[model samples]
Target: MKSAAVPRSAPAFTPRALACALSYCFIVAPAASQNQPHQGAELPAVVITGARFPAPAAESPIGATVISAEQIRRAGVLDVNSAIRKIGGVYGRQSLDGSPDFGLDLRGFGANSGQNLVILVDGVRMNENELSGAILASIPVDTVERIEITRGGSSVLYGEGATGGVINVITKRGAGAGAGAGQASGYHGSLSLERGRFDQHDARARVAYGQGPLSFDLAAAHQGTDNYRANNAFRQKSISGGFQWAAEGTRLGMRLDSARQDMRLPGSLTEQQFIDNPRQSLTPNDHGSTDIDRVTAFAEHRIGSLELAAELAHREREVRAAYGLLFESAYRSRQTQFSPRLRHSARVDGLHNEFVAGVDLVRWQRDTSFGSSASQDSKALYLRDELRFAQLSNARLAVGARHERFEKDEANAMLGVPAGAQSQNGWSLEGSIDVAPSLTLHAKAGRSYRIPNADENGYRSSGALLDVQTSRDLELGVRAGSDARSVTARVFRHRLHNEIFFDPTLSGGWGANTNLDPTRRQGVELEGQLSLGQAWRLSGQWQHVEAQFTAGPNAGREMVLVPKNVVSTRLAWTPAAPHSAELGAQWVGSQRYGNDFTNTCGARIPSYATVDARYAYRVGAWEAAVSGLNLGDRQYYSNAFGCRSGIYPSDGRQLKLSLRYQF
Candidate 1:
């Protein structure tokens, strides 16, 4: 074996001291920036999706990080993972397969991160009911307006799978210029082309035309790559078209989107093999393909202080995977969703107040090549209200609650798997207060629940299904800032019972997903931004997490594949309007290997750090940019399914250049 074997080692730091410092520094600095933005103030918030309405970050408790489209473009990021990972509190593990479906972890959920968070696209649930998780790469970065990452359990409004947090990606469409952009008029469009390492090629274009109360738009993108590893190539293409109309206080819109992709899977490698040659393919013939189509229709009406909105959507997806001769399969799924919501704003006893109420109904059905099938149905209702006392430093207080019910059913058998039907309910409560105009304090308590996905239950030891997993969540945070300099600091804890995960040692070494002993996850997240003068800007996030079992012989043992510390920072120089440059760095701390429940690996996925830089020049309607990833070309691995093997190394350094034109 090579020296790259992961090693378990204690990090050098004191959590208590750091936590205190984080709060003190942020609290005191707000006063300095009140008259003006701190230095380089963090990007101004366009909207706080965490509130489920048009509210600014200073008025909301969740205090989410908002990544703008301009930031993504300037950094030359191509996917959602790369676009938002720098915000500090979240960690996106590299995809094990050829797809860009990064398993994003909020507050250290480990291998089952997909089941601990919710991802929404314009209010449409992107998470799948089964193991197939959300497909982030399907939405081209070019079609994004902004991404809101609320890093804490948000089940009160988002429902289910929001124990860790929620990621809401707001896509750019003809449906108005996004939150608070008001109504756009005239015609707008853009075209772009890019090429990079590994024989990668990408092309995209979008156009929008608006006149009076009606507007329409269309967008298309295609990407192909030889990939960094052998047999890990893919070709993908997507197209979307939409139309929207607005008049008086009423608005309506509809959209249709489709995508197709074909990819070759290189599979995983043994530790020694990966160390020898990270790009070699262990299963050269493995490959797969997927297709998805979706449509959404929405309407809204506003009267005085009251507003009503609703949406109906349907989607279909099919996937085929071939893992050599006899081990091949196909999966298909269908989903439907209907949501209705109402918002009213007014004043009670001379105090400003607002209330929001909503309902969500969803259905999902999936079938596998092995003749097994599963279905899920959900119904939920939620309500929240905010009251403000302008006479007292414009202080505000808000509270929210939600109740949801879910039903699941499964049939047939794959690999002697047992099927069952089950029911579950979830609920939450959250509140926040503004102690000062620039500083807000928030506290939230919630209960999160999840039923086993079809794959998680496939190998249950008994005919009875695995128990429904649940967690008690608590979070507290302080948000402070002026214009340029701002800070968001938070501390959170989640105690989980019946946590579901895969254990390779179970069933005598034959891996199987199962519910485990009680476990607890606690963490601290801090994000701050500062700008000096007009040419330089600084921003970043730092996170520390502890995930461990709370019961049994392995009590207090750290969970596998959960990083202890992650930091992302960047420095940008915009000396002038036409030329700009940025340098960014990220460090991921070490943790146990996947499925290492016994914690006997004696080794951990080694900690690694990387740097990236980008430079761009613009003139008229044209722009050109160049970027480099992993400038140091450090060799490391973030994905390992076991202590002995199943290692997937990270990508080496790569370079890219792109050109874009806007009109």
Candidate 2:
């Protein structure tokens, strides 16, 4: 499927959108107060991810954020990245190729962020063994029940690729057998349609049924768009389904998901080219397509005070791309994973304790058209214990450790023996205490590691395998406030060694994977939210980071593509029943470019701010919303290549109108 190119002179807001907005306003204005509903109520506590078992975020020692399904619907965002970007201490940018995939940065890892951060769906690892990172587009927003983010290292609980943090996306599931079977007798479903600027169109449907010991859910979605820039268009289709069965003491579940996407890549623009016309496509002929299929099955059983669970999952993906008459390539990857966990709780000497142990095994293979084929096998085991001291002001302590091994094999012997086997171990310790009724203090320290991936270890330019990247981190945090409002502040520092990075100075400027000297990343994060009455609410976050090499040629230089300061704020109003509006602003500070690791290029990306707004109304089973992004029409770039040769521009002003019906 293809969409016609949107003209450059198209207006940001069309007449039809304006008319609809006016009509909605007229219909909802007078009836607002008549049906006024309660607002500013506190939400229920939810389970936090990156932990052995379900626990409230406020009680966990780790810094975390939970984005609820209601919030996702209110924001009217189509992509998971956009929904996550609204939170604090997170930086997300579109990929350079103009695909829906996003490059994420957490804890100031810069270009290595993709490998440092771990993303999961329903507790299944989504981070591939390759360099493409997570495919956030595969899981549609309609299927997400909630998303949980845990900042800082979590290798003890989640294993590898969690040096920076972890993001776990939890999907919706049916109720327990015999609990809601009578209430679920009827069909429940929802349909949504969205139309936006740049000729963008989206349609989605979700349906579910539950009876006795069986329940099922199915969803499908399609989206197409003629993007702002020339030769940058995208079309995507996805379908997903889930089934569950419950018995006396056991529950079984299975899920199947698939997605296909085709997108035209406009490439990047030079500094002069950007200043002249940001929408022009220098590489108009570049394009790419991707197909993905995944299936997962899980079972759980409870006996006395112990619970046991196991999962088996498989995923396959194929990618094809052509780069403007220069090169065409095809790649395929298949991965299979198995994990089993056991948890038990008990009380020892008046101290409540929970113990958890898990084992994970994963094997994956990749084949590329460039005669590069490789397979990887990884095995890991982890154990954690949490103890609560009710006699000591509700103090809590957690300690955990993990061990992992990696084996790599090359299809061709010419690839230099496929890099040697690698192994690493990590551990974490954290403690928290309640000083007062509304004040808590916590401290944490941990060591984490990440093994090199196929592209990083088996590069054709250099037939050498890099050592595992390792880091030690320490953090102190304070949280104070009541359930109605809260404030959180944290200070953290990380010392890194053997950091793996691609160096353009090696292998005749084609770039090679190399390990860097000692480095450090220290930062502070502040976040607060308040309710000023029943109708108004406000929240904001501020972060500052200093990331640099400590002992190297680029010593004392800031890391490339890492901003020093970032700020975001939002204000929301709920005047009456079924009506709400939110306005948000985000400011990003300037930073060095990708190829200027030494900070001697005299080139720096400038700072910029953008404003976004959304208004939503719901009555009965119908919802209507209008959202505007980059309302100020700001021009900014998230990433750039060296020498100012390739800069990727962000989208300009865009407005979307959506309608949803549920039954």
Candidate 3:
């Protein structure tokens, strides 16, 4: 791989730090410029779909990065994974089969990375766990209208588990202007079919229409493929539908989504398996299956300066899998949650003040046919207020707090454990100050605590209590940029207490839940976008992470899979009227440590880089595109943890072509 264009400097600012700085700096310029006094029929107020108040992206105070719908269509991305991977400061890890179940490494946080990043679908959080973490694999992108990305901890306005950042996925809404300016009225829809080089086949369709106050959207998709390798084959089916009703001061909506997946489990093995026959590590009957269903109903009311929103949702999830000769498991889980929020915007003492408050209540139940059955409940209330100090040039201050409680119930008597529960309370404070019209500084320091899950705390046939994981994170950063160029950088440090992990030394011998040590992770990221001309654009980024087991039996050991370096670059060209071209490449460094700390890979897996290219053309109302993934055909392991068993090589060359029409 070519060396990075930017010089490698000491890792000072991490992803969290850079994100904070960039966010503070980016939010001011556009909003201040858009707020300048204007005349005549004020260009129809643009509504920011992710926020409660009706504010334009260019006028809202919250730091936001918008990805236009046109961009997605032009890029010919299949789902959310392809859509956001190109964005700077973003990293992802996928299964050997390249399915959507990926672990996101945003900035520096690892393992269940989405736990700190919140995702909202039309202003409602998409997180399903009692801990409130995002389930990216379950979210369908077919109905997404736009995406608003806010870098940095958002617990102040959003609730817990918002330490990394917030990514709001806005769904299509009617009664607003048509997708294209001056294209109101009429109906539109699209259908696409894709067949890639590796026997990958996908078919999708969507339809939508609006007359006045009522509108609806329906979409469905199916994808299947033979194993990229011996044990990587998989199949998936999904369907979703939504309806909306809007009037002068109120809007109501409902949505239903479901997904089913059948996956072959390619289990990795010990040193013996690698020396013997690696291909034999995956059994013929070893497989994993999942089914998820969700329903949500919400209402919004806008009365003058006050806006009120509320939502009720239900979700059911099931997972079945077989693990080598040790154990075969089947898990069923259900969750119900209620969220209500209120926002008020007005001029207080001649200064623009926005206050947002909300409450979340969740109830979740889990049952393992051959294991344990348990139920957990949690509730939280949070409030945040942003004040634009009147008369202060490009300055703003924010304050917020949250209160929470957790409870649990046990039903499996064989475990010989009594039914007991634990409660945890935590709070956070965040602030941002724009120093100049183009530069801004931001900081957030918060304490987050999570109670142990049923399996971690109550299930113990051998009489052992699983430890709870808790942490305190402090972050700071700065960002600067303009129309022609933009740069973002950040630094952060996290301290974990009693970091419960897998024990890896029991009868079943897998990583069993246990709090064994203290750990820390800190890093920095630098990213920039440069537009050389109207038809030419260049973007690049670099990240460095350093995680340590500061104290405990694992002291001084580097965290697993926390690579020291990550980099990427992209060049886009639009030379003529009907065609556009793009070339991009990404590099991922090697990572270590095995399924648990006890088992470790002593050698580096080697770093590898891959390239992607695309060609797109438009003719009247019809658009066509062809794309190639891993054009370089570089041989690498996507899942190095399982590579020793030869079960996780990256997919071979994949090519896809698509065509769409607007009716």
lDDT (CA) per prediction = 0.78, 0.79, 0.64
Superposition error at 181 for model 2 (Å): 14
lDDT of 3 by residue, 222-304 (tens): 88776445566788889888777777878888988898888876655443443343333355557788888989998889889
RMSD of each: 3.1, 7.1, 6.2
Compare the candidates by lDDT and give the number of the best one: 2
lDDT of predicted model 2: 0.79
What TM-score does candidate 3 get on C-alpha atoms?
A: 0.84
Please rank every candidate by TM-score, starting with the best: 1, 2, 3
**TM-score of structure candidate 1:** 0.92
* Selected candidate, larger TM-score, 1 vs 3: 1
Rank by lDDT, highest first: 2, 1, 3
Residue 584, candidate 1: C-alpha displacement in angstroms: 0.8
TM accuracy, model 2: 0.91
Q: After superposition, how far is residue 519 of candidate 2 from its true place, in Å?
A: 1.2
* Worst-scoring 10-residue span by lDDT in model 1: 1-10
Tens digits of per-residue lDDT, candidate 1, 503-563, equal 7777888977788889999988888765555566667777899999999878988899998
Model 2 clash pairs are none
- RMSD, candidate 2, Å: 7.1
Better of 1 and 2 by TM-score: 1
Model 1: lDDT of residue 4: 39
